[model samples]
Each structure stands twice: as C-alpha cells, then as structure tokens.
Target: MSIELKHLRYADAAIQHGSFRKAADALGLKQSNLSRGIRTLEERLGYRLFERSNGGVQPTLAGRDFLQSARRILSDLQTIVGAANAVARGTAGRLRLGFYTSLSAGNLRNTLCDYARRFPDVHISALEDARSRLFADLRSGALDIAIVTGEPGAEFGTSMALWSERILIALPDSHSLAAKDALTWADLKRERFVLSLRDPGPEIEAILIAKLVTPGESLDVDHHDVSAESLKSLVSAGRGITVVCESCMGSVPSGMVFREARDGNGSTRVGFCAYWMPANENAALRNFVQMLEERCPPLQP
Candidate 1:
C-alpha cells in the first residue's frame, strides 16, 4: 500500500499516548480526524492496530510490531533530512583538493591538518600533480581547489595569493661552490641548471633568469619531465645544480646541499596561489577557505 509519511507519524503519536483523544490534542489534530487516519492506515495494512474500549485505546498484539517499524522509519527520515540540510549549508561534503609536487610538508600540509581538525565531517581527498594537470582538472570540475605555484589563469577560476617561498640554490655537496658561506647569481655562470619540466619549472626558470642571470647572458639550463624524487636524484648524481624554494630544501636528496642565493639584495621569492571555481557550491570548500584565511597570514602581494 502507498502509505504516506504523515500516516506513519500519526500512528507513532497514537501509540505513544495510547489514546486517540490525547494524541489528537498533542498534535493539534481533532480526535475524529486522528482516529480516522489511524483507521485508514490499519485498513491499508489489512490489520487492526488498536484495541478500543472505555479504558481508552492500546495497541493490538500486531500493532506493537508495526509501531516499532513506524518509529524507526520516522527517526531515520529525520536523520536523512538533517544530513541533507548540513550539506546544503556547506558544513559537510567531500572536498577534492589538488596541489603541486613537493607541497606535502609546508603551507599545504599545515592548512590540510588544520582543516581536518576543525571540520572532521568534511571528507578531503588530495592529488599532487604539475600545474597544467592541476588546472585542467580544476577547469573540468573534477577538482574543487588547486594549490599551485605562480598565477592561475582567469579562465581557471578565482585566484587568491596564498603563500610565497624563498629561492635557494641546490648544489652537489662536493662542488666548489658548496664550500662558500653564501653564493650569488653571478657565481652561477657556466653552471648547468637542472629543473623539472613541470608547471612551476617554467615559473622558477623565469624568476632565476630575471634575478640571477644578467641580460644577454646565456644560461646552461636543463629541463626534465620527471617526478620531484627523480629531479633530486639527477642533482645528487652531479647532473647539474638547480634552484628551489626554502620549503623544498627539506625534501632535497642527501647528497645535495642548499645555499642561500644572494642576488646583491635579499632572497629571491616565488609565490603560490589558491584557485577555486567562482561557481563552486561545495560547503566544505567554504569552510576550508575560511579556516585558511583565519590561520594563514595574508599574502604580501
């Protein structure tokens, strides 16, 4: 039978009060209407739900079993409604996050840990990839947010400057320049610069060329399409020296040493930005971004 939810609720109320008159009073329903509703329900189920007498009404033996099911169904429906409301309010749901390679230990890690602690109900799944892939997934709606180095395109989504990293020179431990207290861009002349052919690679190359290599000077640079681990391996084997951020120094291979790059000024800097679709409706993303803004300092240009 196509029994409605209101019928189930009326059945539960009647059973709880054990009297049609009392249930109707509590529910703001008239006694006759409540009694008629219960009678209709019992008829649909082909069973008597209550034993009526001058002592008022009580569940028939079969009615008790049916009432138990009714109570559970009503409670479960309420729970379902509550969960839907939470999702609509952006307080719960899955968050698909993407980040650039070698980002697991720095700002991204701190932001993720803090987000998990504050919003335990929000499920977060992350992917690490190059910038091209990250932005591709972001545009296709497969990714909700992306943490990438350099500026994100306007077509990709709304971008917020998140954090910056200081450029450091990575040198072989046995290299002559490694013995120096500090090194400058001018010292890098004739040095083979090894970089990964990845998203941030081009960005980093531009920065290094601008800051270290003088105009009209040719730089010996190598770009490899490989993972971060493989990149470090190449540097450790004396393939060439490369530049990296202070944040990435922790993950540098054992044979590689990091040196401050003094460009006659201070540290040369690279920036990272958070990208999200302006139309994204995920509530978890809202909470995550809010938490990030609260916990992280604003990006200085």
Candidate 2:
C-alpha cells in the first residue's frame, strides 16, 4: 500500500487536535472515515500510530515521528505547487533580453524599469551588444528578445516598431553652435565630426553621408575605435563634435552639450524596433512583448 497526501494530511490534523473527532470536524470529514484513514496509514507502515484514550486520541511514539515528517512533506509540496502555478501564469521565469542602445535614460530604460516592477519574479538577463550579434543570439535561442535601432528587416525574425528618440549633436561648451537654440543639418555640414567605430557609428556615418555630404566634397569625420560615451568625451575635449541619440543625453561628459539635430521637417529622430524569433514559445518573452505593445503601440499611417 502507498501512503498518499490525504493520508498524511489526515495524520497531521489528528496530531494537531489530539482527537479524531476534532480533526475530522476540522477537515470536514466523518470521524469514522478519519479513523479508518489513520488505521490504513498505520497498516501501510506496519505500526500503531494513535492510541485511544479517555481524552479521545493521542499519538504513539511512532506516530509523533510520522506526524513531524508529514508536516514537512506538506510544506514542500505547497512550495512546489506555488512555483509551478507562477510559471504557468507567466509571472515567474527567466527572460534573456538583448539590446544595443544605452539605457542611461529614455523609453528603453523606462520600459525595463516598468517590466521589472510589474513582474518581479521574472529574472531579467540584459545583454548589451552590437546589432548583428543580437540577431544571431535571438535566432540561436540564446536570447528571448532584442531591441535595436532601425527596422530589423524580415530576415532577423518578427519585428515591431516600438519607440523613437531624437538624434542630437554633441558639441563643446565653447563651440559657436552652442549659442544657437537648435541646429539644422546644414549647420553640421561644415563641422568636423568624431564618431565611434562600432555598430551605431556605422549607422551615424550613413546618416551623415545622406544628410551633410556635399557633392564632390568629402565629409570631415574621424572614426574612433571607442564607445559612444568615449566619443562624447572626445567632443568634450574639443577634438570634434559627435552625434548621439537623445536617450544618451543623461550621461554626457562634462564640458559637452547636446543640440537637437533638425532637418526641413523637424528634429532628426531614430526609430527603434523589437525583434524576436517567430517560433520562440517562452512564456516570459510573450509577457514582455505584450507589455511593449501596450506601452508603445504601432504608429498611425
């Protein structure tokens, strides 16, 4: 005969009340049924559990040990059930996230904070890397989602437009352009630019070419093997101006300032998108994607 959860539960209740009648009333069972369950449990273990007394019932020395073990078993089973329920509800699990943008400040940073607060049980593993690698990781199942600059195209996976941030020009405090309230793309044409030799650096170079590149003239831009922040540091030292997204404005190095880069329409803004595998079935990923959709809905045509 196998000992079941109900049998252990019955034994524990009887021990707690020290009476079959009281335990049966507490468990909403008939006294005779409670007594028989206890008797069957004792038979399974080949030992007497409770001794009938004038007080109603009391545990034998062997019954005391069985009750103690039964209580522990019940506690562990409760923990297991709770954890499984949390996973089933998508509230508890691991989320592997990939992003290339700086979270110094902006929508990306705010979204992360909101997600953490809303789903405390989700263990978020945030990985910062280049765009190509983020896509590679997503395809390999190493990442659940990736947020990056520009439309991630159809080949990466499913993509959604999430948010957009202004493209700002970083200039030295003493630069003449600092005196202006804002700057136009034409204003940046004659200026020397210092850019990173990284993922966004290439993107920035492309923008500079499209916006400020004059026919039959080369752009005076220096490519530095450094991070975006380091590129800003170069601008702070008056080496040359650089461009960064508005989100990066939070941590601009001292002596440097940011100006909104504008075109004929308005501020030059970079759009960001989220990418994930079409076949990814991670519940945690689904929850995060849903949160993004609610916070940053698709723009109207």
Candidate 1, RMSD to the unseen true structure: 2.9
Best candidate per TM-score, number?
Answer: 2
- The residue-by-residue lDDT of candidate 1 on 161-244, one tens digit each, is 777777788888989999997887778877898987776778778877786677778667988987666777888899998877
Give the number of the best model, judged by lDDT: 2
**How high a TM-score does candidate 2 get?**
0.90
Error of 2 at 254 (Å): 1.0
Over 4 Å off in model 1, which ranges? 17-36, 53-56, 296-301
TM-score of 1: 0.85
Task: Compose the digit string of candidate 2's lDDT tens values, residues 1-301.
Answer: 6887898988899888989999999999999999899889999999988999978788899888878888999999999999988877779988999986678999998998999999999999999888889888998999999998886478757999888999999999999999998999988878999988876788888898999877898889898988887888899999999989887977978899999998889988888889999898888888999999999877789
Model 2 C-alpha lDDT versus the unseen true structure: 0.89
Lowest lDDT block of 10, candidate 2: 148-157
